[model samples]
Target: MKIGLYFGSFNPIHIGHLVIANHIAEYSDLDEIWFVVTPHNPFKKKSSLLDNYHRLEMVYRATKDYKKLKPSDIEFSLPQPNYTINTLVYLQEKHPGHAFSLIMGEDNLKSFHKWKNYEIILENHHIYVYPRVTKETTETQFDGHEKIHHIKAPIMEISSTFIRKAIKEGKNVKPLFPENVWEYLDEMNFYK
Candidate 1:
C-alpha cells in the first residue's frame, strides 16, 4: 500500500485539512492518507498546543468516518522534538509492506532544504505537494525534482491558528471543523 503521511499539529482538525487529504486520497495514487498528529513540531511552540491526547482524539473524531483518511499518533510514542526523518525510518521498520510518502504544502517546500536529512528523505520517499496560498516562493533546487510530485489539490486558507483565535474570542467557528470534531471541542471547552 502507498500511504501519504499528512503530518500536522492538528491543534484542532478542521475542514480544510479534510478537504486536502480527501482530495489527495481520491485523486492521487495513494491508497490511504494518515493524519500523523505530531506531539510536538520542531518548527512550532509547544506551549500553544493542546494536550497530545486531546489533539489526537480530535483528529480521530474528524477522520473516523472516512475510509481513506485515518488518524495516527505514531509520533507520540517517539522521542520529543522528533524530526520527520526519524519518523520515516521508524514507520518503514514497523510497516515494511507499505510504501510511505510525504504530503506537504508548496509553502513548506520553500523550507524543504532545512529539514533534517532532507536529501536522504528525498532519496528514499516520494513527496506529494499540494497548493498553498503563500507569498513565499518555493526553493529553486526542488525545481523539476523527480522525487517530488505537484498535486493540483485545493488551496486551503483555513488555519488552526485562526480557528483557535476565533474560539478564544467566543466566536462560532463550528463550520470550520468536521461535525464530530466540532462537537468534541465544544463539549471539552477547548481553546476557550
Candidate 2:
C-alpha cells in the first residue's frame, strides 16, 4: 500500500488537518495518509508543545472517524529531536511492504536543505505539496525535484498555534475543530 506520511506536532489536531489529509487521499495515488505525530520536531519550539502522549491522543480522537487518516506514534520510540529523514528510514525498515511518500506544504520544502539527509529523502521519496498561501515560494527550495505533485487543496488558514492561542485566551474554538473532537478537547481542558 502507498502511504503519504504527514509529519507534524499536532499539539491538537483541527479540521484543517483533516481537510488536507482528505485532499491528499482523494487526489494523490496514496491509499492512506498517516499523521505521524512528532514528539519533537527539530524546527519547532519545544516550550509551547504539549505532552507527546496527550498530543498523540488528541490526534487519535480527531482522526478516529477517517479510515484513511490515522494518528501515528512512530516518533515516540525514536531518539530526541525527531528528524524526518531518520524517521522515514526507520519506517521503511519496519514496514517493508508499504511504500511511503512525503506530504507537506511548499513552505516546508524551502527549509528542507537544513534537515539531515534532506537530499536523500528528496531523491528517494515522492513529495505531494499543497499550496500554503502565506509562505513565500521563491525562498522555499525544491531543487527541481522529480515526481513532485502540486495539489490545490482547500485553504483552511488554521494552525495549531492559532488554536492554542485561542484556548489560552479562553476564546471560543467551536469552529476550529470537528464537533465531537472540539467537545472532547474542551472537556479535557487540553490546551489549558
Candidate 3:
C-alpha cells in the first residue's frame, strides 16, 4: 500500500483539511492518506498548540467517516518536539509492507533544502505537494523539480490558528469545522 503521510498538529481538524485529504484519495493512486497528528511541531511554537490527546480526538472525530482518510497518534507515543525525519523512520520500521510518501504544500518545497537529511528522504520517497494559498505551482519557484508532484486540490484559506482565535474570542466555530466536529469541541470545551 502506498500511504501519503499528511502530518499536522490539527488543533481542531477543520473542513479544509477534510477536503484536501478527500481530494488526494480520489485523484491520486495512494491507498490511504494518514493524518499523522503531531504532538508538537518543532517549526511552530508549543504555546499555539492544544493538548495532544484532545487534538488527536478531534482528528479522529473529523476523519472517522472516511476510510481512505485516517488519523494516526503515532507521534503521541513518540518523543516530544516531533521531526518529520524521525516520524518517517519510525513509520517505515512499523509498517514495512507499506510504501510511504510525503504529502505537503508547495511552500515547504522552498525550505526542503534546510530539512534534516532532506536529500536522503527525497532519494528514498516521493513528495506530493499541493498548492497552498501562499505557495504557487510555478516552474520559476522550482527549476524542473521531478520528485515533487503537484496535487490539484481546493486551496482552503481557513487555518487552525484563525479558527482557534475565533473560538477564543467566543465566536461560533460551527461553520469552521465539519458537522458535529465542532460540537465535539464544544462539548469538550477544547479551545477554552
Q: Pick the candidate with the highest TM-score.
A: 1
lDDT per residue as tens, model 2, 1-192 = 999999898878888889999999988789999999988877678988878888788788888888899889998999997788888899999999999999988787767678798778978888888878674444555655576777789877898888888898999988988787787788888777
**Which 10-residue span in candidate 3 carries the lowest summed lDDT?**
135-144
Q: Candidate 2 — which residues are off by over 4 angstroms? A: 135-144
Give the whole-model CA lDDT for all candidates, comma-separated. 0.94, 0.85, 0.85
Sort by TM-score, top down from the best: 1, 2, 3
Tens digits of per-residue lDDT for model 3, 1-192: 999999998987899989988999889989999999988888989887888888888888898999899999998878877678888899899999999999987677778888888877887788888877864544434446676778899998988889888888999879878776888898888776
Q: How close is candidate 2 to the true structure, as a TM-score?
A: 0.93
Q: What is the lDDT of residue 115 in candidate 2?
A: 77
Measured against the true structure, the TM-scores of the candidates, in listed sequence, are 0.97, 0.93, 0.93
lDDT of 1 at 174: 85
Query: In order, what is each prediction's RMSD in angstroms?
Result: 0.9, 1.6, 1.8
lDDT of 2 at 192: 72
- Residue 60: error of model 3 in Å? 0.6
Tell me the spans in candidate 1 whose CA falls farther than 4 Å from its real position.
Answer: none
